[model samples]
Target: MTRTLEWQVRVGLSEEDGTTRAEAVLDTGSEKLIGHGVARCNPQDVDVPVIGDELAASRAMKDVAAQLMKAADHELETVGAGPASGPVAPPYAWSDTTA
Candidate 1:
């Protein structure tokens, strides 16, 4: 079965200090999840700050992945019931965009 997902992202920055903020939203039609992050100063700046938008987006997707993995594992374990060992296969697999 194939699942469809919809997502959105927004980034903002502070004019004075160049602080950056990012927000991401993930929705699966039936459910929704959100992630927010911030970055301050420039990477080349003396203080050196983390890049918020990238961090936020990446982390958010990571969280979603974790959740999906856990759910898949649980389902597989339940269905197997007598799993004796060996590698637990992922319920689903996806590949990154290739050009």
Candidate 2:
């Protein structure tokens, strides 16, 4: 069977008092999920607004990914398929030599 599905994700960001906050929302037609993240600049660190925005946004997206994985695991359990052993690893890992 050939099927087409569309999922939409929206991310919003705000900065205040040297802190950046991000919210990521995903809509899969039948369901909606939201994830939030915050980034704070240290007093001694340079005040780079863009860096904070990036960090907060990435963290929020990671939160959304975890939620999606949990949902999938639940669905598997419902179907009598055992829960996943653990969270799946990322496609690649950072290496000290590559940095």
Candidate 3:
């Protein structure tokens, strides 16, 4: 069987106190989740707005991903399945899980 669907995500970024903050909203048709992230430049680091935006956005998405995983795990439990094990972490999210 094959199925297709769309999920909507909106991310916003703002700067304050030498830090950038990112807020993300995910709409999964049946539910909504919020994710947040922040980026701060060190005193010695070159202050770059784009870098800060990228870092904050990446972190916020990570937050949203955690929420998505938790929801899916809950659904699996609803059907008597066990919580997902092993790793699905960032920077290596595509690793094959088979042994």
Candidate 4:
């Protein structure tokens, strides 16, 4: 069986030097961390470069993952009884419902 962990990413913006810079926030329940530095302001402020968006998002995700691992590995202690060692159930199965 496979288990899914939930996570969420939030984007935020701030104005600096007449241009809006983007930032990202990651929520993993146990830990919350702000990721990536704001993209450099554009010349016109209204026009945002494509490359910046990609870079900013990528950086944020990387940072979030790093933070999560650091917290999990703290003091060699396991959290929440540690990840399941054995598969709890088959990957996929179905029960008959037709009469």
Candidate 5:
């Protein structure tokens, strides 16, 4: 099949006291999902706004990636595929090179 698909993502962040909260949205052509994450500045650590944003944003993006995986798996079951064999692992899921 020849098809073109695109999705839009937006992230927002807020800071209060020593806490930073981030929210991310994924807007697929037919679906919308939201994810949230929070970061805190250590009491004895220097406050860096950019650092907080980066940490919180990373967590939020991870949260949304999980949602996308879950949605795709749910749809795959209806594509004439046999029942899954136990739990399925995502392509190239986290791996460690430890013996």
Candidate 6:
């Protein structure tokens, strides 16, 4: 069965008092999910707005990913497939190889 599905995700970022906050929202037609993240700069560290935005956005996306995984696992269980054997692994595993 060939099926086509499209999901839309929107991310917004804001900064206040040296802190950056990000909100990511995913719309899957039938449902919507939202994830939030925040990044704060240390007083001794250099101030870089772009860096904070990057960090906050990445974290928010990570939150969304985790939510999606949980939803998938629950759906599988609902279908009698049972929950995953264990925690779902991230797309990439950390490696010690020096580039």
**Against the hidden reference, what TM-scores do the models get?**
0.44, 0.81, 0.80, 0.48, 0.82, 0.81
Q: For residue 94, give model 3's deviation from the true position in Å.
A: 8.5
- Please list the C-alpha lDDT of all candidates, in the order they appear: 0.56, 0.90, 0.88, 0.62, 0.88, 0.90
RMSD of 6: 3.9
For residues 32-65, what per-residue lDDT tens digits would candidate 3 score against the true structure? 9999999999979988899999999999999999
What does candidate 4's lDDT look like per residue over 61-87, in tens digits? Answer: 667667666565553345554343543
lDDT of 6 at 92: 69
Best by TM-score: 5
Residue pairs in clash, model 2? none
For model 4 the TM-score comes to 0.48
Between candidates 2 and 5, the one scoring higher on TM-score is 5
1-99 per-residue lDDT for model 1 (tens digits): 997765543333332356655555656566555555555665576643345545545655666566656665677788987355778655467655577
Report the candidate with higher TM-score, 1 versus 3: 3
Position 67, candidate 3: lDDT: 88
Provide the global lDDT of candidate 3 against the true structure.
0.88
Off by over 4 Å in 3: 84-99
Count backbone overlaps in model 6: 0
**lDDT of model 2 at residue 12?**
99
**CA error at residue 52 for candidate 2, angstroms:** 0.7
Alpha-carbon shift of residue 27 in model 4 (angstroms): 1.7
Which ten-residue region of model 4 has the weakest summed lDDT? 82-91
